[model samples]
Structure formats: structure tokens, C-alpha cells
Target: MSATAAISVRGLEKSYKGSRQARSPVLKGVDFEVARGSIFALLGSNGAGKTTAVRILSTLLKPDAGTALVEGASVVEEAQRVREAISLTGQFAAVDEILTGRENLVLVAKLRHLPSPGDIADGLLERFDLVEAGGRKVATYSGGMRRRLDIAMSLIGSPSVIFLDEPTTGLDPEARLEVWKVVKELTEQGTTVLLTTQYLEEAEQLADRIAILHGGTIIANGTLAELKALLPPAKVEYVEKQPSLEEIFLSLTGSTKQGDHS
Candidate 1:
């Protein structure tokens, strides 16, 4: 493992046993390194083994072959230590629906045995922009607010790395942007984030490094500019620009809102 790497993997392979003679291979000889305090995105379509890779790295599953290390600790041999150093948020929001946002955070903080759990919860609620909704039940919060609270709960332990698996899957465009801002804030605070998403724009917007996983392997890995360079140069064409559907919707809505306010 490199000294500068927060996470490292080499020759990682995993397969699931199916019927007597059948086996389903997910990850095949996967290798990658994540630099400390940077966002690394694993971009892939459904069934591309992105979630499998995350599960293995987060110590929820063991690799059939090869090695993975989290902050110099072996994920296989030192899973407990690895778990202590990382937090994972899955595809769906994990906050308790019956609990208020503040209660949800306080629950996690207490579980982590942090001193002054209430103070930690209050701080995170403020940091995640949930202060206004802190006393509202999670069921009453918007999808974006619940997602933000989920991430804030994960931070109670102050882990060095966080794994987000398709976090914005069901969110609207505005909600997606809200999650993006949270991700940016995390990286700015020196947290290493590994997020898996099928959205090309999501990776382009947030990832410092991107790995494109295809057919159970990494087909390309580099900065966005470097990956773009691998493609043929674009041929310039002269054409009239037209507004997209999203732009049209926003424009129409803006006009309606202004008229109502007037």
C-alpha cells in the first residue's frame, strides 16, 4: 500500500456460488488506489459489480482472492479496525422514519459512545443544514433532508473514509444538487469519499479520479480530462442552440413564480 493511499486494492476477485456447477463472478482482478482526502468515483451501470466492490472494501464481504487495505489495515485480516475507519451509506436513506432528525443523529452518536452525544448531534444537524428540521420527524422531511441526515449520522464516528452507494438514485434534480454540495463539503473537510453512481454527470461533477467499471473489470481509470483525451477529438459543427426540456421547465416555472409573487 502506498503511504499516501487511504484505500488500496490489488488483484481483488470475488464470485458467488450458484447451482452445483454454476458460479456468478462479480469482481475480477480489480485493482485501484484512492488518495487520501479526495473523492474517487466508481462509475458503472447496473450489474457492473460496483456495489460488490464497495461491500468488499467496507468489510461487509470477503474477497475470494487478492488484498484490500484501508488506511494501512487489511480489510480481510483486520475487518473490525477497517470498519472503525470507514462508514457506508447505501442506495436508500437509512434514517429512522419515526425519529426526529435530531433524535436519529443522537442515536448514532450514542451508539458510537461519543462523549456529549447531544452536542455532536446538534453540531452535525447544523453542519448538514438540518437545524431547521431537527425537531421534525424523518417521515416529514424531504428525501434530500433524510439523505443529508443519513450522511451526518455516518460522521458521528469521524471515520476517515465513507462509501456512498448510488445516493441520489431516487432524488429529484434539486435534491441531487443538495447531496452534491454535501459531498463537496466532506472532501473540503479532508474526508476521503468513494461513491458509486451510474450518472455520468455525477462523476464528472464531483470525482477527482474516476474508474469506469465494465464487464466486471475496470476498463478506464483517470481524471475526467485524461479519460476525455482517450476519445477522438470532437468535430466542430455550426448549429443553432435550442433550450433543453429541463431549461424550458425551469424557465416556465420561474415566470409563473414571478407572476404569482407580483
Candidate 2:
């Protein structure tokens, strides 16, 4: 493991027991490293073990094989230390609809046994741009707002690393962009992030480096330019760029990111 790497994985493997006696393999000797304060994307389709890798690294699930280190602590051997150094925000928004946004943030801070939970909640609410909505029930938040609050909640303990599993899934283009901006801001604050997504544009727009998981192993790993270099350079050709359907729709309907736009 590199000294500057916030996460390091080598020869990772995992499998699950299926019906009767059959075993289904997911990860097969996977390996990668994420530098501290950088965004590393894990790209793969459904059932490609992207989430499985995150689960193991976050110490939510034990790996069947291989070594995973989070902030220099072994995930399996020093699970508690790993947990203390990391936070996870899964695909779905795990907010309590029954509580207001402020209440939700305070809840997580308290759960982490942090000092001045109320102050912590206030800071996060302001940081996430949820000040006005902070007093409102989470049930009323838009997909973007809910997702933002979920991420803010994850920062309650000030974890050094954050695992965002398919963070922008199911969001509208505008909402997705909103989350993208937030992700960019996270890295700017020196937080290491491991993002998993099936969205190609998401990875292209955010990751400092990308690794593609296919058939239970890493098939590609490199920067955007490096990965693009793998393919033959395009022959020179001139073509006019046209606005995409998303641009046209957003231009025509002028749908706001608030309310039911999600």
C-alpha cells in the first residue's frame, strides 16, 4: 500500500451462496488504490461487484479474500479503526421522513457520540444548503435535497474517507448536476472519496482516476486521458455540436430542481 493512498486493495475476492449448494462469484482478485483527497470512481454495471467492493472497504461486509486498508488500517483486522475513519452514503437516501432535516442531522451526530450535536447539525445544514429546509420534514425534500442531507449526515463524525455507492442514481439531470457539484466540493475539502456509478458521464466529470469492474475483476484503471488513449485516436473531422434532448427539455419546460421535479 502506498503511504499516500487512503484506500488500497489487493487480490480482493468474494462469493455468495445461492440456492441449494451453488456459489456465485462476484469479485475475483480485484486490486486498486485511491489517493488521499482524490476522487476514485469504480464503474460497472449491475451485479458487477462495485457495491460489494465498497461494502468490504467500508467494513460493512467482510471480504472472502485479499487485503483492504482504509487509512492504513486493515478493514478485516482493524475493522473498528477503519469504521472510525470512513463514512458511507449508499444509493438510496436513508433519511428519516418522520423527522425534520435538522433533526435528522442532529440524530446522526448524536449517534456518533460527537460534541455539540446541535452545532454540528447547524454547520452541516448550512454547508449542504439546507438551511431553509432544515426545519421541514424530510418527507417534503426533493430527491436532490434528500440526497444532500444524506451526505451531510454521513459527515457527522468527520470521517477521513467517504464511500458513495451510485450516489446520483435515479436523479434528474439538474438534480444529478447538483449532487455532482457537491461531490466536487467534498474533494476540495481534502476528503477522499470512492464513488461507484454506472453513469459514464458521472465518472468522466468527477473522477481523478477510474477503474472499471467487469466479470468480477478490474478490467480498466487509469485517468480519463489514459483510458481514452487506450483507444485509437479519432481521425480529424469537423461537425457542429447540437444541444442534447436533456438541454432541450430543461430549456422548454424550465423545470425547477425544487418541489416535484425530482
> Per-residue lDDT of 130-184 in model 1, one digit per residue for the tens?
8999999999988898899999998888999999999998999999999999999
Tens-place lDDT per residue, model 2, 1-262, is 7999999999999999998768899999999999999999997767879999999999889999999999999999999999999999998999999999999999988887888999999999999999999999999999999999999999888899999999998899989998999999999999999999877678888999988777798877888776765554545559634443223222333433211211
Best by lDDT: 2
lDDT of 1 at 245: 24
- The C-alpha stretches of model 2 lying farther than 4 A from their native spots are 239-262
How much is 185 displaced in model 1, in angstroms?
A: 0.4
The ten-residue window of minimal lDDT in model 1 covers 253-262
**RMSD of every prediction:** 8.6, 7.3
Model 2 poorest 10 in a row by lDDT: 253-262
Q: Which stretches of candidate 1 lie over 4 Å from their true place?
A: 238-262
The TM-score, computed over Cα atoms with residue i paired to residue i, of candidate 1 is 0.90
lDDT of 1: 0.86
